[model samples]
Target: MPLWTIYHPANTYSDKDKQDFAKDITDFYTGFGLPAFYVVVLFTEMAEPAFFVGGRPASDTVRIVVEHLARHLDDPDMRRRSTERLNSIMVPYTRDRGLHWEFHTYESPRDLWMIAGLFPPGPGTEAEKAWARANKPLPY
Candidate 1:
């Protein structure tokens, strides 16, 4: 189960755009065996001039970083080559230049279940319960 929480400036995106973004995320997870239903997405919109860093407005700075990541999606060596490039692009705009951002990934079996009193769990509920029992930490 992959949960995505997106936070952006208010009015920056529309409802249709949000749905399309969700579809993209769902497709990405489903390709790895996790279906759309198992993915949770939350979009939080903030007003313009509402977010600031180091006393400077975050309008242009935030857009630049997001656009850069979106542009490197098709690179075959993205994970290896684009690592340093992203950091380099973000240096001049920020207060700190030495700070770097790195991406990491992992895969594991996930379990989902529902409680009888709270909500009735549908299909795959039993499997998730069993997996939860074996995993030690039950994630509802």
Candidate 2:
């Protein structure tokens, strides 16, 4: 499972912007073969004052924290590809404002996460594959 969290200042983005960000993020992860039901994204708006970068109140910036099955950390190429795509998707929203941002992927082992009372089958596993196949309204 992959869960993406976006933390940005309130005025930094419009409602539609947040909507697109979530959709784009889910698409990015699902491209890796994960099912849509397993891709969770959240947009958390915070007051600019609530965030600080280098001890200075953040004025123009975005922060993305992604949590996924620890197994994903085993692939260096995937990380590189994902980061590149993240930059492309974010440039339109960050560049014009001269904003700074970082996307950090943190590993959360399968056992550490649960979905609907069951642990994820773990990425790239047969169980995960079967679950994806059984699920509908997704990129089956």
Which candidate ranks first by TM-score, i.e. highest? Answer: 2
lDDT of 2 at 29: 65
- The lDDT leader among the candidates is 2
How many residue pairs clash in each candidate at the backbone level? 0, 0
lDDT of 1 by residue, 14-115 (tens): 798678667765665455433345555677665667856579655433332121111123465765564454344334423252322232322332233323
lDDT of 2: 0.74
lDDT of 2 by residue, 11-97 (tens): 888888877877776687667777777777788888978988899898777898878762555688977876787678777767756
**Candidate 1 segments exceeding 4 Å error:** 60-140
lDDT of 2 at 81: 79
Q: List the global CA lDDT of all models.
A: 0.45, 0.74
* Model 2 CA lDDT for position 77: 93
Q: Model 1: how far is 80 from its true place, Å?
A: 6.2
